[model samples]
Target: MKAEISQAEKAENLSMTNWFSLLGLAVAVLLSSLNISIVNVALPRLASSFSVPMSEVQWLVVVYLLAMTCFMPIAGIWGDRFGRKRLFLFGIGLFFCGLIACIVSESLTQLIAARLVQGIGAAIFISLAMTFVSDFIPATKTGTAMGILGTTSAIGTALGPVLGGYLISHFDWHALFYVSVPFCIFALLLLARQLPDNAPVPFKLVKSGRFLAQFSENPALAGSLTANVCVSAIIMSTMVVSPFYFTDGLQLSPAQIGAILSVGPIVSALTGAPAGKLTDHLGSGTVVRVSLWIMLLGCLLISASAFWTSVPVYLFALILVTAGYAMFQAANNTAVMTEVKEGQKGVTSALLHFSRNLGLMAGASVMGWLYLFTSTFFPATQNQPATAFGVTFLISAILVGLAQVMVSLRKGR
Candidate 1:
């Protein structure tokens, strides 16, 4: 009786610690995600203040994304060698310093440089955050934990524009950077207190190579990563193209376009927890397959909306795509992380993020170019933008279809 009671108490204590750790991790996720989105609203203001063209100010956003992508893999390797908690603390501190630099910057060059520093710090924590679920959460609840992270991320994405607008309106553009400082401090303190330190591993470049080589041996990991890249590309493409489509094709005002665009992140936030529950009950593989089908269907609907010029159809399709993405993200992360070899969790997580950022960069450039190229071929008398939108989404659907086929073939084999 005494032993049973002791075991029960230990379990409860561990559970409490896990929840606290998760809270810290969630805050980190929110901070990183908010930064990704919050800066866009300030770009015009920044350009005016710096006396530069929009093209020059745009580098502030692009440089951050580029730095995050470039640094993530290295950060992962360092996390494993030096201890993730220590590295994560360093990352938060670096991010705080970057924010201070951004607030005090006198030139566009200085602000862009500060953003690069911030991105590197964001990369470190974002890559390590998923690994924490594997470390601290019970296996059965992994999906739910991932879902919570997804929800936090979606909330940050959804809130960034609104919050940035409010801050810029009431205060100054610098307030956009200032808002995150308190949250970063809180995350640092909570994580420092709650997370247990892991034993440091010997650093090796060969280990990263060996981990990459596992893609050939581990079909599940390969398929999940491939799907991640494709889905991320498709999602980013929608974000990049949809506003132009709404304006040129549907003839909507900027306010209406903003309202419509907001639906995707809102739906993603709303669906994240439920999707995670579904993943737990249905299994990650099953949830992934279903989510892909949903996304494909949504893409088709989006294509149809281009032809019909129906706002309702577009809204419904956005909900489906975003909700499906939320589901896929939770299940896919669970699947990929589940297959990580011992001692490689940090690198594996980093690779997952790298694939996503790569996809986003590709989608922004390639998809926009594709839309422009296709638009030129259409007659001016026709709804050229709408036709281009339709064709672009049809191609996106094909990509999603290809991913589903790949996953199916791998499962069959």
Candidate 2:
């Protein structure tokens, strides 16, 4: 009886600690994602305040992205070699300081520099957040934990524009930075108190080489990573091209276009937790296959909308695509992290996010250019915008189809 009771009590304690730790991690994830979008809304005000051109003010966003991407691999290696908990705390603290610096900055240069600091901090924590779920949560519950984190990320992303707009309107641009301070403090306290530190692994250059060799040898890992890149590019392409389509092809107002565009993120947020659950129940491979099919269908529908020119069809297609992407994200992330060799989760997780960033860059540049090139082939008729939109999505569908083929071939092997 004593042994049984002791075991039960210990389990309860662990459960409690897990709960608190997850909360801290969730808040950290939210902060990281929120900052990415929140800063965009403040660009005009920043330009005016700093007396700089919009192009110059844009560097604030660019610098942060660059810093995050460049430092991610290093952060991951450090997290594994040092300790994830310690690094995560350090990241949170650094981000907090960056926020303070942003609020106090008297010039655009100072603000941009501060954002760089925040970006590096974000790279550290965001890279490690998924690894924490893998390490601390039971394997049986990994899907559910991943889903919760996914939901939190979506919420943060969805909330950023709305929250930033509200804060900026009511107070000032500085309010955007101020709003996160309390949440950051709360996350730091909770994580410091509840999260357990993992033992540090020794870092060696040879081990990294072996990890790379292992990655190349593992079809699932390589396939999943490639799929992530393709999916991110597809999503970013839609974001970059959709507004023009809504305004020119659909003849919609800004408000209507915003409403339509917001649906994608909203659907993503709603789908994340359910998708995670599905991933758990159905297995990552199965879920990923289904998600790719759903996305492919969405792309076809979007292409059809060019002729249909129906707002409802466009919106439905957007929702389908976004939801499919969210599901794929959860399942794919789980698949990749599950495949990581012990003591290498940090680097693997970082690589996953880094691939995503690369995809976003490709989508913004290459895919956007593709749209422009395709649009030029169409004569300047009233339907020109629709035609370009259709062609772009058709190409996107082909890409997704190729990804599906790659995944299938890997599975067959």
Candidate 3:
């Protein structure tokens, strides 16, 4: 009788924790995605405000990811040592500080530094958000949780451009940064209240040290890492190039561009659960490969659009990319969580996020460099079109091809 009563009590407590954690995490994830989307939309305006070329201004995006990537692994490990809740709060606080710094900055240098701080904080909370989901939910339900998270990501992504456009048009570019601050504070307070308050658990360093070592033995980890980096590179490259292309090549307004761009993420956010279920049925390796193929087609379409100067084709291409992203996220996260060992959930989550942020940094930096190089080396081409951008997409397609191969080899143990 006592055993039955204790089990019921434990179950009830876990259920409460799950609801609280999921609610807080969903809000946090949404806010982050929304801010990112708005930032992407406001990039050109930011460049105009600072009187800098897109090349220099793009560093605002690149530096943020670089800082986040650098911080992810360490944040992961530290969250394990200090308590995930504490780490989560710190990430929020740091990000809020960066936001304040950005608003007041008079120079580009100051803004970049502030963005770096923001990225580091973002890395901490984003990494721990996954850990919280994995810790709270059962393995069988992880796909659902990730799907919900992915959906949250999609919602923010979809809404960002439209909302951001409205803000930039009516208010100003600064409004984009301003909107996220209060929401982030509220989410922080709520998250702190909802998350588990247990003391940090200690684990042996030697056992924890094996994350990379063990990574080699797991095909899922290896393939997922490769896929994440490549796929994200393709996505980020499109983000950097497309806005410029839309305004310059296509001559679209921010409002019009946001409307067009919103389609992909809307498609993605809607398809998340279905994709999760498909992954549950078909397996991660299969789903990942298939999604990459779809993304490949999208990449090819966008590259072709640049060469041919086809506006319709470029818009169509975004749909494919969004669909692939939605499917890939739902399946990939589930595969990763399944592969992680008994301990080190936080670390594993960090590593996955590390791979992702690295991709974001690489995508923005490499593509931005290519853009600047084209402008510098082929001054005549600048008058022509997104001439260098076409070449970048072709390179990204090959990287996607390589990622497809990695996941293909992921078979039975």
Which candidate number maximizes TM-score? 3
TM-score of 1: 0.87
**What tens-digit string does per-residue lDDT give for candidate 1 at 1-413?**
99999999999999999999999999999998788666655554566777886457657766776777888888888888778899988888888889899888877888889999998888888888988889988888889998989988877866665666566556766777888989999999999999878877765632653446657767667777777878887877676567567656766554455456667778998999888888889998899999999999999999999899888898899889989989999988887787676578888888888777766655655776688789989997459999999999999998899879877866776
The pairs that clash in candidate 2 are none
What is the lDDT for 125 in model 3?
A: 90
Model 1 ranges off by over 4 Å: 1-7, 40-58, 105-108, 164-173, 203-211, 244-257, 372-385
Candidate 1 RMSD to the real structure:
3.2
lDDT of 3 by residue, 1-413 (tens): 99999999999987987887887888788776675666676678778888988878888888888887888888877787778899898898898888888777778899889888888888889887888886778887788788888888888878888787778778756566787777788888898888876466566742563457647656567777788988887777766667776777667788887787787778888987788778877886678778988999988888898888877887789889878977888889888887675457777888888888788778777876775576455455434446766777778789889888777766534
TM-score of 2: 0.85
Q: List clashing residue pairs in candidate 1.
A: none
Error of 1 at 40 (Å): 4.5
For residue 26, model 2's alpha carbon misses the true position, in angstroms, by 1.9
Question: Quick one: ranking by lDDT, best first?
Answer: 1, 3, 2
Off by over 4 Å in 3: 1-17, 205-211, 217-220, 372-383
Off by over 4 Å in 2: 1-3, 39-62, 104-112, 164-176, 204-211, 243-258, 303-309, 368-390
Clashing pairs in 3: none
Cand. 1 Cα-lDDT: 0.80
